[model samples]
Target: MHAIPVSQSLPETLDPNIFSSPSSPKVGSEPQGHITEQVQTIWNPYKNRYRVLASCILSFANGMNDSAPGALIASLERDYNIAYGTVSIIFVCNALGFIAAAFFISTLSTRIGRAKSLMISEALLMIGYTAIVTTPPFGVVAASFFVTGVGMAMNLAICQVFCANLANNTALVGAYQGAYGIGGIFGPLIATALVSRGSKWSRFYIIELCLAALNFGIAPRTFWKYEQESKSLLPQPASEQQDRERGTVKRNDRTKRQWQSFKTLMSNKPTVLGALFIFAYQGSEVAISGWIISFLVQFRHGDPSKVGFVTSGFWAGITLGRFTLSFLAHRIGERTFVFFVTVGALILELLIWFVPSIPGDSVAVAFSGLLLGPVYPCAVHVFQRLIPRKMQISSLSLIGSVGSSGGAVAPFMTGMLAQHVGTFVLHPICIGLFVCMGISWFLLPKAERRDE
Candidate 1:
C-alpha cells in the first residue's frame, strides 16, 4: 500500500482517485513518502476558484429545475380546468419521486462517479421536461413530474457533496448553497415573466430542457480538466507496494467509519434538533410556495398573472436573503443569525396573513421569503460542522430526505385544509411552522466560538 498524505481538513482540489481508488493510503497514518505526495496535491488559489464556480453552476441548475415546476402549476391548472386538490397531486408525485430517488439514485452516484451521476440526472430531467411539454394526459403529466423528481433528488443529494469536496473551509458550505437560492430566485421570475407574456406553459419546460442539456454538455470537458489538474499533484504509486502503500486503513474500515459517523449523527441531540429545525423550515417554505397562487387567486381575489409575479417576488427575496446572509452568518454567528431571521419570518408571515391589498400581501410575502431563506442552509452548515467529513454525504442525504418529507406532507395537508376550510388558512399554518422553527433554533447546541 502506498502511503499518501491526508489532511485534517479536506483538500480544495479533491482527486476522484482519492475517493475511488481502493489502493489509496489511509488518511492521518500514512508513511512519510505518501505524506509528501499527498501534501503536493493541496489546492492552489486558481484551482479552488474553478471548483467553486463549477459547484455553484451545478447548484444553479438544481434550483432552476426545482422551482420551475411549482411556478408553472398555476397556469397548468387553469389550462387544464383541474381542481386545486387534483393539481396538488403533482407535488405529491414529485415528492414521492424525490424520496424514491433519495433511496436509490444517491447510492448509484456513489458507485458511478458523481459527475456521471449528475450528467445522467440532467439528461433525465431533459427527458422529463420534454414529456411534460409534449404529452397531454394528466397522468402523463404527473408521471413526468415524478421523473423530474428523480432528477431533482439526485441533483440535491449530490450537488452539496460535490461542493463540500471542493471547499477548503467547512464554513463556506452555506454560502455555496446560497448560489442555489440565486438560481431559485431567477428561475421562477423568468418562468413567470414568460408565462405572463402568454407563452405556453410548455415553453418553460422546453427552455429548462435545453438548459439542462447545455449544463450536461459542458460538464465533462470542464470537470475532466479539473480532475486531471488535481490528480497531477499526487505522487506516482509504487508498482509492488500494494499492501504497505495502501496505508493502514482498509475499505472495510472506511465503511465502518462512515457508518459510525452516521450513528454518531443520529444519536447526537444537536443534530436531531437541527434536523427538526430544517423540517419545519422546509415545511413552511413549501407551504407558502405551493399554496401562494391558490391563496391569492381563490381567497385574496388577485389575477393569475399578477399572482405568478408575486410568487416570483417571494423567491427573489429568498435568493437575496441567502446571498446576503451567506457572508453575514460567517461574520456574526449561525445561532444568533438564525434567531433574528426566524423572528423576522414570523412577523412577516403575520403581516402577510392580515394585509388587505394584493400589492401589500405580495410585499409582505416577499419579506417573509427573505427572512425564511437563511434558516435551512445555515442549519445544514451547522450539521456539516458537527459531523465527520467522510460521512457528510450519507448523513446529509438521510437528514435532508427526512426533512423533505415535510415538503411532501405540507403541500398535501394544505390541499386537504383548503378543501375543508379555505385556501387562506395556509398563511396561519405557515406562521405556526415558522414559530416552531424559531423555538427549535434555540434548542440547537451552540458551536463553540472560534476567532474567524
Candidate 2:
C-alpha cells in the first residue's frame, strides 16, 4: 500500500507527542509540515517477519498464562485447601498488576525503547513464574501472578502498538490475537494433562518459565534496533537544531501533556463507549475461560481431568473463530456482525446454564468462544474509523488497559460469588456482560467510511 500523507487537521488542544516518544511519532502523528511514513509491513520488508514472529511468541505465552488458571484452579483448591473466594485472590492481585502496568507501560516504552521495555516485561514474567513453580505459600503464589500480570500488560501494549502501526493492520492484529488463542488452546491441554496425571499444580508453571525464558532471550535481539527503525521510517520535518529543541520541550512537559490528553480522551463519547464495549467484551470472554472448567466440574459433576479440557475446547473455538470469522467481519459490517454474535453468544451461554448435560454445555461453550473471538478486532477497526487518527494510540491504550481490568474484575467477582451461590453464577455474569456489550455497541458513534 502507498503511504498516505499525514492529515494536518488535528485539533490544537490535543498533544500528538503524548502518545509517542520525542523522536518517533506513532502511526498517525502529524508533525508540522511533514508527511508521516508508514511502518514496514511483513511483506514490504521481510525482516519484520522476525518481529512478528517474536510478538506471536509473546502473545502465545500470554495465552498460556491466562488460560492455565481454569485448568489448575481445581488442583490449587485441592492442594491448598482453600475455598473458592480465597483462591480467587490471585485474580484480584493479577488485575492490580495489570492496572499498575497500564499506567506505566507507555512512559516506560518511551523512556527505555520498545526493546528494553519488552525485555523487562519478560523478566517480570520469569520472576512470576519462578515464584509460582516453587509451590510456595498461597499468598506468595497470588503475589507472583501480580508480577506476571505486570509483565503481560507491558508485552501486550507494546506488541499491539507495533501491530496496529503495520500495513494491513487488521490482518496483522488478527494473526497476533489468533496466536493468543492457539496458546489458549494448548495451555489448558498441557495443564490438564499434567495435573490429571498426578503432577502438582505448581509444576505446570515450569513450562511457562521455559516459555518466558525463550521470549526473554529472543525479545532484545529481535527488537533491539526498533526505535532506530521507527525514527528512520517516520519523516522528520525539522532540522537537527529544531529537532533537539522539540525533544527538549517533549521531555520538559511530556507528563503534563499526557495527563491533559488523557483527560480529553475520558470526556470523548466514542472513546468512553469504546472502552466500555471492550471492557464488557473481555469480561465475558475471560470469565468463561477462567471459570468454565470449574463450572463444568461442580455443576455437571464431571471429573476434573475430563472437564479441564473443556476450557481448551473454548479456547480452540476462539482460535478457529479468530482465524476464520474475523475475515467475514468486514464483509458483514462489524457493528451488525458484533450484534449478531453477541446475541448468539448470549444464547449459547443460556444453553450452557440451562442445559445441565456436560456434552451439551461443552459444545455451547466452544461456539460461544467462536462468536466472541472476532468482536475485539472488529471493535478496534470501528474505533480506528470513529476516532481521530492523531489520538488513536492513546485512545486504544486506555481502552485496552480498562478492558484488561474487566478480565480480572469479572472473574474475581465470579469466584467470590461462586463461593456462596455455586459456580452456576458464571452464566448470569457472562450474560449480563454480553448485555453491557450490546448496550455499549449501541451507544458508540457511527463509524464514518474513510480510506486507510
Which candidate tops lDDT?
2
The clash numbers for all candidates, in the given order, read 9, 0
Clashing pairs in 1: 1-241, 1-242, 1-243, 1-244, 1-245, 1-246, 2-245, 2-246, 3-34
RMSD of each: 6.6, 5.1
Question: Tens digit of lDDT per residue, candidate 2, span 264-311?
Answer: 777888889988888888888888988998998888899998989999
- Could you give candidate 1's per-residue lDDT for residues 97-138 as a string of tens digits? 777775456446445655687688788888888897784788
What TM-score quantifies how close candidate 1 is to the native fold?
Answer: 0.81
Q: Can you tell me which runs of candidate 2 are displaced by over 4 Å?
A: 1-32, 44-46, 239-243, 246-256
**CA lDDT scores, all candidates in order:** 0.65, 0.80
